[model samples]
Target: MKFKDYYQALGLERGASEADIKKAYRKLAHQYHPDVSKDPQGEEKFKALAEAYATLKDPEKRAAYDNLGQRSSGEQFTPPPDWQQRYKTDAAGFDDVDLADIFAAFSQAGGRQRQDMPRPGQDYEIAAWVTLEQIFRGGEIEVGAELPEYDQNGLPHRVAHVFKITIPNGAADGQRLRLAGQGGHGVNGGRAGDLYVVLAVQPHPLYRVSGRDLYLDLPLAPWEAVLGGNIEIPTLAGPVALNIKPGTLAGQKLRLAKRGLGNRDGSTGALYAVVRIDVPNQVSPREQVLYEQLAANSTFQPRAHFATGAGA
Candidate 1:
């Protein structure tokens, strides 16, 4: 099982306002509709956009989706025996079925043949892990996935499927790469379900991701934070010099515009460098004497606020 990122499908941020979601859906719907676009996969993209929007537009569905956070995509995930019982339908009298419901139903049915009607194989989601650098530089990924093949009566048998997926440059964490007709096999000549490989960027050693933006902790010496200067900073592409303003405080964030993740619209997200002041744990005799002398000479009272009765 793989997870789907509804926010990515609509090309919107996770924190995108409701108005933003609506605006993005309208634009994508028009651009990707098979009738309006010449893109080879226009119809497929359109369907996915609709599905993503449907899940996100509903607050109840969105909340449920968020609960399953950061699970590895593009890999096999076996649901618990009582998965269905845990996620029973709570929506009452809702005319439309959300994506979460569809996923739960598929897990319970396990591709069982129902009555005499031909049924298509259930759609599946797999998590695919990629690095922030990989998203910065678009490339292909090959992952091993266990695809289920259904028998004539809709009994599912597992098959090992090797997938080579092309990742889009600047792809966000919740974006999905759709692989058509690669999911569970069709039963009674019905069409095979689509496979959605949701892109999950692994946590980077240097950067933390929030939507498309990247955040990095920049450790600076206490002196450096107090008297800042030009410092070298690492980016996805290469290293660049950053001007650290004088009197920068710890925990203060400095923004590097358009230096983070890439987007489909040719825009990139900003990178935030958060200041972290480092202090030497130990010092030589000479250094200790110098520090003592400086402390005695310095009148900078850090505890002045505590001394005042304002907080108390």
Candidate 2:
């Protein structure tokens, strides 16, 4: 097998921190994973990513591979002298992982230990967005996922297929949902892998969701604000008329019951509809003359407070 430069492929510096490596991997994985990505070489790139991760995720093997340099590009990977003595030691500070699993491939290729290598099926990621209604109702979202074909030895042949997904309700943005046994094919009778769906909720044009409560910008007519009447307000469910008290002003908020998002603690939040009176364009000649006559009787000044701060 031809050796790949894991760091370059991952867009990382040799001196990159572990957190940096993890962040880079997450980004590249999202870009190359077959399910969400339509890149022509997504499958190929994903497999290469899996291979690179399999190496970089292991601190010992990563240290060794980082030192390999040009010697790795040859058909077979023959480690330089003292490679085993150099990296054969178990890693410190790494818990819950076995170093043997990562280096087994190299060993099977005659680097160190002669153990059978069973590569893990690759993992996949997808990004999805949901509407507030969908978030409340919870339903299946069909997405196209393509997985690469694998060789007998478990390396990828760069072939894939599209698959769908069913998303649940109340899913927040940046959430990841996993589908088991849906990743790259396994090798040597190993088990198939898994797929992940990443959530990306698009912002609503009128409503801003905070936790379970939703805030809406409700446009009201000037007469509606001044005279108080039932005005149609938009909600996640649909449009409903809300009673606006007489002499209502801009920037006032009305709280509606049972209209916010569902919370995890078995309670729902209230939706706040903020009021903003809109002025009419091109008034009728008679109405314009009436307004001019009404101005003489009206002593109200909306910007009376402006002069208080004018000289300060």
Report per-prediction Cα RMSD to one decimal: 15.5, 10.6
What do the candidate models score in CA lDDT, each in turn? 0.73, 0.68
lDDT minimum window of 10 residues, candidate 2: 89-98
Of candidate 1, the 10-residue stretch with the lowest lDDT total is: 89-98
TM-score of 2: 0.60
Task: Give the TM-score (vs. native) of candidate 1.
Answer: 0.60
- Measured against the true structure, the TM-scores of the candidates, in listed sequence, are 0.60, 0.60
Tens digit per residue, CA lDDT, model 1, 93-168: 1222233444423433443446445557668877788888888999888978776554333334466788998887
RMSD of model 1, in Å? 15.5
Name the top lDDT candidate: 1
